[model samples]
Target: MKTILLKSGYSIPVMGLGTWLMNGRECFDSVLMALENGYRHIDTANAYENEDDIGQAIQTSGINRKELFLTSKVWYQKLRFKDVIDQCHSSLEKLRTDYLDLLLIHWPNKFIPMNETFKAFEKLVEEHLVRSIGVSNFTINHLEEALKSTVLPIAVNQVEFHPFLFQKELYQYCKEKQIVIIAYSPLARGKVFESDLLQKIGQNKDTGPGQVALAWLIKKGLVVIPKSSSEEHIIANLGALSITLSDQESSMIDNISENQRFINPSWSEFDA
Candidate 1:
């Protein structure tokens, strides 16, 4: 349960349970398991269509709201000012919370103006509906444009990050801007479990390869959220907190293939 300091002066858990591609009772059961375990952070989004299930999990777990850190996002299609405002309220309603610990723009909408979206974000913070605001899937240029305005503090940038998709420049830019880099898909979508190198490293540490990947990201000061529906994987993923990578091992992970990204969409502007 270590924490990372955000620019907005809030502390976020270094490890979180990512609820993506999970729905209904499965999502509820998974989240309940995570909370029952040592997890204090939970990540969901409007695009995921499972906020209600997540809310149900939270309500049933009986964990106090203040004791948990919940993060949800407004999807790309909902990037307009009006949509942003409405969606924030919708998300809050579905989450069964008066406010979100962190609210993020799910994706950069090339068609929408950044200032307009941020203005609504500012209003949310002003009204105490959101503690902090940030973006997801934002590259360096996207963040630069969003940072141009003095509307609000961009607290975090969650992205597809792992040894296979290591975004060095984006990571450094966020670091220099005091923006927390939240690593979604930190295990490379179960692909990390296939790598012999990761396995060897995990063997040295007496753990699994996925844990090795998580440990590497944690060692680099990045917050990681790896999604899992299985209780076994959920418990195993949390075990990553105990695995420490050597400087050399960290460097070894750094040199792994970086051309893979699991969550690419047709509308994504990754090359631009």
Candidate 2:
């Protein structure tokens, strides 16, 4: 697996297993299969509610904890100082780990002062509870606010990104600031297969559309976490690492016209 170095001096896998809707036995089996088959990064969150199953999978895999990069997020509603601490400890307990490689603010909550939330994040880092901290679903405005709120480096920004919704401006901003962008929904919730362009690229490359999508993001130096519970898909998705895109192929995907978004809550401030 390839990795990108973070501003915090830590590295994260370029592609990871995304466990969003997966749960129980399915989550365990999928995670176990991923770990056994070369995936070293596992992305989950409190909202996913499958940390315990992932914990079991990791424990059963017999892989050293230090060898894997585990990332979890604090929910948007839990940004209060005490709530942040309590939620992180809860996540650690559920994930069966003493520390997290990366912890993030799942979403930007306007009601929560960025300073207070980042203060709790800093406290976690100071106590060796979290290695690095970041945010998710944040716009450039939100990131500017986050940059103003903390002295610690904002190591990453996990967001919904794919061919259809290429956030070029935000991507460049984070790049210049040294904040890695983790592309969740890198497949656009299965819509990748519907794209004639991605399908054409995949056919030309002899790979699936999903792999093409992941490869495109990887080519742009972004980390991707595409979710799957099927062992076949999991193994196939891992093959994305081997894909090498030509400049014209990359350009075709970049010019995709749709500005579609798959995940958006009523509270989202994407325009802001």
Candidate 3:
């Protein structure tokens, strides 16, 4: 797997496994498969409610803890400074890991002061509970508010970043700030697989459309996590790390961006 260096000087695997809507034996099997297949990064959250399964997979994989880059997010309801620490600790306990590679605020909630939430993150970093901290679904304004509350650099912002919803403005801002952008639905929840352009590109590259989508993100230097429970799919997703997209092919996909989003929730004001 290729790696991207974080502000903390630690490297994150450019591709990872996403554990949303996965649980029980299914989640455990999928995670173990991913870890055994050279995947060093795993993205989960407190809201997912499957940290114990993830923890078991990691323990049984026989992979060194230092070799993995695990990430989890705190739910929006836990945005208060004290609650942030308590919730994070709960995640740590469930995952059976003393420290997290990265921690992120799941979403921006108006009820909680962003500054107060960030201060709690700073404390986590100071205490070494989390190596690096960041946010998800944050706009440029949200990021600015976070910056004002802490001296510790925000390492990355995980977001919905498929070709259809490129989020160009936010992408540019993150680049300028030297903050990595982690694409959660890099495959657009399988929507990208239905694209004609992606199919053509995949045929030419001797890969699947999913791989083509993932390759496009990697070519643009963005981090991606595409979820899958099938071992074959896991291997195919990892193969994307080796596929390189040409400028013409990349531009073809760029022209297909429609600013479409698939993961918007009632709690979020983000509409596309």
TM-score of each: 0.97, 0.97, 0.97
Compared with the true structure, all predictions reach lDDT values of 0.91, 0.93, 0.90
Clashes of each: 0, 0, 0
Which residue pairs show collisions in model 2? none
- Write the residue-wise lDDT of candidate 2 on 1-272 in tens digits: 78999999999999899999999999999999999999999999998999999999999999999999999999888899999999999999999999999999998888889899999999999999999999999989899999999999999999989999999999999999999999999999999999888888889889989999999999999999988999899999988899999999999999994889999887676234
**Pairs clashing within candidate 3:** none
Using lDDT as the yardstick, the better of models 1 and 2 is: 2
Expressed as tens digits, the lDDT of each residue in 1-272 for candidate 3 is 78999887778999999999999999999999999988999999999999999999999998888899999999988889889999999999988899999999999887777789888998999999999988999889888877786788899999999888888899899999888999989999989889998999899979989999999888887899999999999999987888989899998888899989898798886311
Model 3 alpha-carbon miss at residue 38, Å: 1.1
As a TM-score, model 3 comes out at 0.97
lDDT of 1: 0.91
**Model 3: residue 245 alpha-carbon error in angstroms:** 0.9
